[model samples]
Target: MFLGSGSFISTTKAPSKEVAKPAVTAKRLMFLDSSITDSSVEVLQLPSPASLRKCALYAVFDGKVYWLRGIKPNINPVSLFVGNSIVNEDHFLATFKFDVIFIFTSLLFLKHDKFISVPQRIYELYRSGVVDSEECSVLESGMLALWNHNVDKVQDRLEYLCQKIKSDGSKDPLLKPNIDSFRAMLEHKVQSLEKAVQKSNLMMGSYCRASETSCHNHVRKNYIDFREGKLRLFCWSVISQMLNPEARSHLVPAKCDFNDISSHLQSTSSTAPLITSGNKGAKQRKITVAKGTPSILGFFKRT
Candidate 1:
């Protein structure tokens, strides 16, 4: 989310500013997502606290506010004021420890969301009466995976939104990190996520059944039905495509959603001793193999 103009937000309308008359109030608008484009850059006529709440991450460029909404329900804000190159995820953590950044000495703001994230959804699940407290505890990781994804990758996504708002003088590529650094950072984070994915599964079975994935009734009620299952968890090749759109090779997951518990199951079985079809003929048969499943499945069973 890039706040294109660098002017302070005013409650009253500024004739010089472009004010958007959103049909819905800013409070209703959730998700400052990866889908940012020049068109989606909006300046609300009257943005309330709730509209500002839509952004999980924010950047101030030139003087206007820009932002990106993340899937996580609770997020502490990290403000990127002018005169910063990049805040590496590692640096974001260390700042809190050492207080090396001068801005930390002063007040910046952040908050928690009561709606529109995994924790909030599970809260509704218990309220829905479809699942018990115990069941909600083992809720699918796909949504959780969305929240737990690498913070740096989310930060890098900020660069594109910033591009949409830059003036001619601000068009320097160095305003963000070089593309190679972006590529390397994305690649490293991706491998780390995949290794974690290979080891994580907390759903009841080997794969999620869409019926059992989320509290469907709760989801439909919240969505304007546009974005319920549409969020990408963390298949990095998708980010890779975003970074280098012209690249010929595609690295997308075939059936994987980066969540081991995705409803689409991976094919892991082989023909079991090829059954006889006719005389001197044999045919292949498919069988489920539960052996390669993550050991954490046992913990769910014990529950």
Candidate 2:
């Protein structure tokens, strides 16, 4: 069922630059019977090309040639001339002509993702029932946020959109499935944040305990070395007065009657052997020497 389709050669040239710009174009035709058909043809121009860039559209139906001539301007709109054959072929040929405006132009520079105005344009188109274009924007936005790990913003936007869709109540069935997928992605991000918090807490607790144990062990080792003569001190007398109460009382408290801390130390250390007094006429006495290091008593004084 061939109604009409045609091709035309467009030629352009600059007077100063002398650059030749040429492109081919196609036009679609619809018949009155509500059926669609395609009948494409390529038209070769003469050897002498024009100096100005031009695009043409030609359609042939029932042995008639329709000429629709158009020109290009810099960045604004351009005027065009349409022959009478196209106008007489179909009653709604004005609408058909509007649809073919982009067919004659260069579409190579058009990009869906890079265009800054594309989001707004797609939103407008979506309101006019062009939903597929809107879907592209949603997919692109979601992928970018996911790649950058912008969890909060993405989750908020997705939830808001999903709730809005739900409130609309089954108007567009195509969007229902997308809401479910968005919810799943939101849940995944929330769970990941929770796990991250738990891991951080566990690591902090382990570090604190390890640091405390290391400090205790360092202090204990230093005291043991000082008591065992393994480490020479800068001032052994000051340290001995701090640790040994008997030594402290002799040096710092001459009149105070202090308890003998060495006897307490001997009573605590099980490694020391006991010695009994040889005199039977006096009271029996037991004296012991500590085999290991004494406890830390630098802050205390014997009563």
Q: Over the stretch 204-224, how does candidate 2's per-residue lDDT look in tens digits?
A: 210111111123544512111
> Per-candidate TM vs. native?
0.24, 0.15
How many pairs of residues in model 2 come into backbone collision?
Answer: 3
lDDT per residue (tens digit) for residues 1-303 in model 1: 222221223223345765673323232223232333332333322111122111112322222333322221123334334346633231121000111010100101111111122233323533466544422332322223222442333323434422222334432222222334334545565666455444563222232222212335565121111111222233342233222111212223335533243333234422322221222343433446454333332211110
The regions of model 2 sitting more than 4 angstroms off are 1-122, 125-173, 176-184, 196-214, 217-303
What overall lDDT goes with each candidate model?
Answer: 0.28, 0.28
Residue 86 of model 2 has an lDDT of 26
The lDDT of model 1 is: 0.28
